[model samples]
Target: MGRKINFIVLTGLVLVCLLLGTEYQYLETAQGIDSGDTAWMIVASAFVLLMTPGLAFFYGGMVTKKSVISTMLQSFVALGVISVLWVVVGFSLAFGDSVYGIIGNPFTYFNFNNVTVSPNPAFSETIPFLIFALFQLKFAIITPALITGSFAERIRFRSYILFMVLFSLFIYSPLAHMTWHPDGLLRKLGVLDFAGGTVVHMSAGIAALAGAIYLGKRKEPIERPANIPFVILGTGLLWFGWFGFNAGSALGANTDAVIAFANTNLASAASMITWIFFDRMQHRKMSALGACIGAIVGLVAITPAAGFVTIGQSVFIGFVAAVVSNLAIRWHERTEIDDTLDVFPSHGVGGMVGMLLTGVFAKDVGLVYGETKTFIYHLLALCVVAVVTFFGSLLLYKITDLLLRMRVREDQEHRGLDASQHGEHLL
Candidate 1:
């Protein structure tokens, strides 16, 4: 019944969009747009859009059966919630005219006012600004969705929704503006984030860590994944979608895009191999879970450096990230905090490592080229991101709690979020 209602609502929305007459009105610019670049960007946007559902499966598969629906719903809902939010004000906050280099002027693109079919050379020379905005909307949608993994099966849906809105408005917008906007502070400082190592992964990962700490532990923690095959399937989807996540940052079908695509695959393969081998050496047996986690860690580690580093550097980045993240996960297991999906280890730590490695291995401007300036700025940016996300998430969590209790009741938790929160259960 609920699914039917949702489907109807979505269908209505689509029909409305169609009826309103969506048309491409290209603004005249001195620089002409390229069809090839536009076509690739169109495909790339779809690829990036697929990742949220891919993440839904990945996170959904990691939890017990009872919480599966709720967990998956958390990610799926972001598609609706953030998509609406992004168009209304989120895009302007993220990519509008620069305001003191900290945020975009909301009025600049409020309701996507000036966004058109023509290229915005300030952002991309070939792709339409609307396409670029939509591409970025996908990123905004995924970042908050990524946090659901940490506090899965425990958090209240209302609180999560509120927090997602607040986080998007406050945390994500500023970071995106500072890092990606031409006159933004981080971009001016020469911070290299080809993709969203700092903006997406790191921000989500740190916020996850804060939530995990705040939420404490699940009453009865399940050590084993409920469905290994589901996890494997999710991992495969995530891997497939990641090409867009990394390469699509190039915003065109060019050399940088090609390099990013190749680097993404190579790094993931290297990390997977390294993770299983490391597990075999340490525990006397390789685990499928380790392989999946390693693959994701590699993907995260390579994102910031995807277009900046050489293939060899990408392999190194993946291998080292796998090792470090593995250790971080192991250490986290021994602690009291319950990060349900090891979000901090895999994404938070991997993103940090990737950002640092980008400083070290980036072509022409890396530490290897004696460019200590880029390296130092990266460190500073990492610290700023860490502090902002951590504290900001904490504050948002508290505010959400005040408005609506942040967690399900103890009884509801024991009953499982699927039945308790969604009134559904896996048969």
Candidate 2:
């Protein structure tokens, strides 16, 4: 099996190398590109890319010491897997010419043939189309990484790599096309996701839920976090990168970007406070874990509405989302499904709350403004996304399980993934 997998991977790499030879000409024009926006976007792209590693640390510290390295590697590997996939067909399937408003034509940007430094007026008029694609690629990279937390300790590393690739191409790409593309069905309905409440957080969260249900429980259901300091460092990095994640969605350095940046910080702050205080109300002591989770949930909840809502609304969004997700965690604990890190509660529920609140608080067309259309469409879009992501992910998991068996052997689980899967361990 190892030899077969290696052969398949190498063959694919060779095919990609051959395809690169077809593009003999380069696009050298930078017409109509704004230097200011371009510069910030380049920085924003890097900031967003940092988040996957941050997530690696964030998730790594929450598992048992034995599972730590494997957990972190799952997140870190997406930086390689998704980057390559995105450049090949993932970007085309997402932002290529619309195929019935549901998906993109894969051939439109095959091998990133036409994706160049020149501005694509349909997506962004100010920055180069290449920058926009790179920024969106970061979002894609972190998404499947987020799902790793759900089935963390017991999943086969190779199986996970396969699942990640499938999830990106089929599930994540369609959602991105539908939500972000100009000709997308959801976009036409005016479902506003300023950053990625719908595309990133919500999809990852629901898929996490599906994964937890599918994978069932880990052998050792309860374990202490491996390292709290790692969690803190991870949280700080996520928070810092999120400024780029949300603000950069504005696609230019303008008033909307400023507003999104402020709202991002304010929402996260409010959510952190709300999370810890709410824990106290529940007779649970406020801890570093609680604070970190709260901050992340706030970031997730405010993502869709980052540019569409005000600072006060963002605060409210964060507070409400934290409370909801906190309760969700409690409910999940009482159930049979073992979401290893509460990925669904923190990301899925938080995203749902954010998407709904964006419908309520979006500047002009929100429920608060007495415009029912946008809010109504948001509800519809949420339901649609939930069904597609949840069911689609389950099917993909089944396919992957058949192909490579998603879970490891019971003996392997007992030995810990660090040793069983990777042949490495912490000192």
Task: Please give the lDDT score at residue 115 for candidate 1.
Answer: 79
lDDT agreement of model 2 with the native? 0.93
Best by lDDT: 2
Writing each residue's lDDT as its tens digit, candidate 2 over 1-427 gives 7569868988998998788778624568678999999998998888899989999999998999999999999999999999989989999999999999999999999888898888999999999888899999999999999999999989999899999999999999999999999999899989999999999999999999999999989888646899999999999999999999999999988999899999999999999999999999999999999999999999999999999888889999999998999999999999999999999999999999999999999988999999999989999999989998999999999998988889989999998999999999977
Kindly provide the TM-score of model 1 when superposed on the true structure, using C-alpha atoms.
0.94
lDDT of each structure?
0.90, 0.93
Over 4 Å off in model 2, which ranges?
Answer: 21-27
Root mean square deviation (Cα) for candidate 2: 1.0
Off by over 4 Å in 1: 1-31
Whole-structure CA lDDT of model 1: 0.90
TM agreement with the true structure for every prediction? 0.94, 0.98
